[model samples]
Target: MSVINRVLRDLDQRQQQQSKGSYTPAAMAPQPLHWTWMIGIAVGTAVVIVILLNLYWWLTIDTDPALQVVEAPVTNQPTVIAATAEESADQAVEEVERGTDAESASKPALQRGPVKPRELVQVPPSPTESRTSELEEAEATTEPVVSEIPTETLATVAPEPEAEVEATDTPSTFAVERVQLSPNELAETNLQKARSALRRGEREQGQELLEKALTVMPEHVAVRSELAAYWYGRGFATRAVAILQQGLDRVPQQSQWQLLLGRILERMGRIEDAYIALQSVDSSSAEYIDLLEVRGNAANQLGYFSEAAQDFLALASLKSEGRWWLAAAVAFEDAGEPAAALRAYRQAAFARDLGVDARRYAEDRLQALGGS
Candidate 1:
């Protein structure tokens, strides 16, 4: 049994030796490739792949070189807009000042007032009227005899006053009583007497006499004319003009009556009618020369220099002397026509030295016309 046991153990030891000899050093150590190492390498490789993909996406997609992006300034939009708008406002203000100076040079200077010129017309006295003296004689004669005085006889009696009687005449001496009065003339005398009484403060007598005179000759021209003068003296110019105009129509050629009518017309502010009446008188007639002067002066005052010139010229022709020539010259100057004015001034200067005033006036006008 012992011997069998030793042999079996030796067999077992031999079997063990055989197993050790078969095992190499590489087999005795761990295996070179393990499951855990393999898993760690796989995870590291996946992490590397993910990092490379992220780097590629960042480089290729996030940056673009072709697009240009501009950032706005820090200022507000309205402020930037205002800065741009300021440059356009300065160009509109320079065009308005040049149009006002060209309009003032085209008009004439002002005249202070209307001017008067000189010239006039003169009417002569008629040769046909009955003489004042003849009327007086007829008034004294009976009606039948007065009627029997021939028209031819009446026409032959000169109406003008006698030169001798005129030289001796005075207001008192020439009173209506000196020559016998017609009924009409007597009524005029009474009216004049009434005016004188009124002027002397004898009012009741004046009124009574005027009433009696009017009763005797209701429409007598002399009586009406005297009453008209009385009313005029009392400041009733309108009534005076009415009466004098009627008197003038009845005796159109009586220069004395016409003179009174002109005066009444002037007093009534009927300037045109006054001028016409004044213009009707003969400048050569001694009775109306004073009236001609009045008419010329009135025409001058009213700016009717042409009418004044006419009056002055008529007066100058009648007198044909120094002062009258000067007056006519002045009238000619005022009426325009420097040539005519020059001729008139030469005539005046030739008549008498007009001093510096007339000479200078003529010289200035002549210079204006290129005549001197």
Candidate 2:
């Protein structure tokens, strides 16, 4: 019985020792990995991936400047393009001219129309007509080439200014049709023709041309003067008067015309009419001296002694001649102004250029007026 009990005790002791060796404490047990270690591992993996990608890109990229592409610079100007187009058009025109010359040489039998010059074309082959013919011929031979030109280029090359162009519809080819003469110009031409006719002794033709000139331009001073002189020299005083009056009526501002009219009226004994006509003469006129003399004479004839004296005094101041002073004295005496007449007589009596008869007349007037 003691031996069996001792064997049970040994077996129990062996089991207790085995249980103590297998059992682990909770504080000493192996725990799951921390989240911080997991986060650190993930970040390290991303950094390694980025480094590998950069190394791959560096290895694949090209580093040579020689293989780089180049592009042309851009411009916004339309004139530059137009200049290029003009150069192209010049080349095209030269080619067209060469072809036309070749065709003419090759087919002498082909009756080609005469090639009108592009510079100046007239008559039936008017400038525009010539241009159209040229364009049509050029298009027939080189339509594809010309068609490549821009519409702007075509517009630039086709039309011309009207002044430089000639018309073909009119039957007459007179140069007068091309040029339009102004009224003054026509009158001038007529005046020249009349002078030529007069020189050639063609009286009727000269008269006709002069009349035609006046009809064309009533205010033509040269033409009117020429016609008036022509009649007055031919002893037709009335005709000269009419022509000059007609000119004055059209251009009253013409001082030369006024002077001529006054002279003609005075010559015809129309003193009153002549004085009135001469009143409009400008003081700045080349005919001013002539105007004063004629007006003074006409004034005396019309009993306007004061006006005559004033006109003669102006003439004396300008001419410094004793005859003018004597005339002024006579005018002043007629005007009933003895003081002014005496002063004028004194000037005339001692004048150096006064004629013998004039100086004696002045002295006699001075004595009669109670002056020394």
> Which candidate number has the best TM-score?
2
Q: For each predicted model, how many residue pairs clash, with residues at least 3 apart or on different chains?
A: 10, 0
Candidate 2 ranges with C-alpha deviation above 4 Å: 1-177
Judged by whole-model lDDT over C-alpha atoms, candidate 2 comes out at 0.79
Candidate 2 to truth, TM: 0.50
Which ranges in model 1 have alpha carbons more than 4 Å from their true place?
Answer: 1-185, 188-192, 207-225, 282-285, 298-305, 320-327, 350-372
Best by lDDT: 2
TM per candidate comes to 0.41, 0.50
TM-score of 1: 0.41
lDDT of all the models against the reference? Answer: 0.62, 0.79
Clashing residue pairs found in predicted model 1 = 116-305, 117-305, 118-309, 119-308, 119-309, 119-310, 119-311, 120-309, 120-310, 120-311
lDDT of 1 by residue, 127-164 (tens): 34325433444555434534577889989986667976
